[model samples]
Target: MARLNFVLLIAVVFSALYLVRTQYESRRLYVELEKASAQSRKLTTEKERLQVEKRAEATPLKIEKLARDRLQMRTTTPAITQYVEYKTAPAVQKASHE
Candidate 1:
């Protein structure tokens, strides 16, 4: 009878230990999940902030200013504009007339 009681006691202790280990693992996983969610929220807000700044930086005036300053480019004016005349091949011109 004492041997049977000893076996039963060991089984109970093992079961208790397994339950504690399972609960500890569950708590750890919950903590990790919460931390990951917080990180996701932080990254989402940062992405939104960067998107807003990108929109602000991509305006037409900003692009023109950067082009003028960095590339030393100028907008074309009528005074500097040139006209081009195209001379077609005689065979192609004749085909078009026909």
Candidate 2:
């Protein structure tokens, strides 16, 4: 009878320890999940902000101004246009061998 009681006590202790370990692991995972959610929210806000800035920077007037200022480009005009002619070389005739 005493040996049976001892075995039962050991089982109970092991079960209690396992429950505590499981609870600790659950809490740790919950904390990590919360952190990841917060990070996701932060990344979403940043993406929205960058999108707004992109829209502002890509306005047609802004693009035209940047093209004119950064690159020396101008609209085509008849005054600056020139015409060129193409000439082909005459073909050479080979002498017949006797």
Candidate 3:
């Protein structure tokens, strides 16, 4: 009867230890999930800000300003424009003697 009681005590201690370990793992996972959610919110806000900037830049007036100022491009009068093309000479045939 004493040996049976000792076995029961050991089983109860091991069961308690298992329960503690399981709870610890669950708490750790919960903390990690909270951190990931916070990071996701931060990235979502940044994406929205970038989208607003993109929309502002896509305006036609902004594009024209960038093209004229940065690229130095201007609308040319038809009389100021000229087209030229170069023609290549034909290749000469080589004679081979056997």
- Model 3 worst lDDT run, 10 consecutive residues: 89-98
The residue pairs that clash in candidate 3, if any, are none
Note the residue pairs that clash in candidate 2.
none
lDDT by residue (31-70, candidate 3, tens digit) is 9999999999999999999999999999999999999999
TM-score of 3: 0.73
Worst 10 residues of 2 by lDDT: 67-76
What lDDT tens digits, residue by residue, belong to model 1 across residues 62-90? 99999999999999999999999998767
* RMSD per model, one decimal: 3.8, 4.2, 3.6
Top-down TM-score ranking: 1, 2, 3
Output candidate 3 Cα RMSD.
3.6
Segments in model 3 whose C-alpha atoms lie over 4 Å from true places? 80-98
1 or 2, which is superior by lDDT? 1
TM-score winner between 1 and 2, please give it. 1
What lDDT is obtained when candidate 3 is compared to the true structure?
A: 0.97
lDDT of 2: 0.95
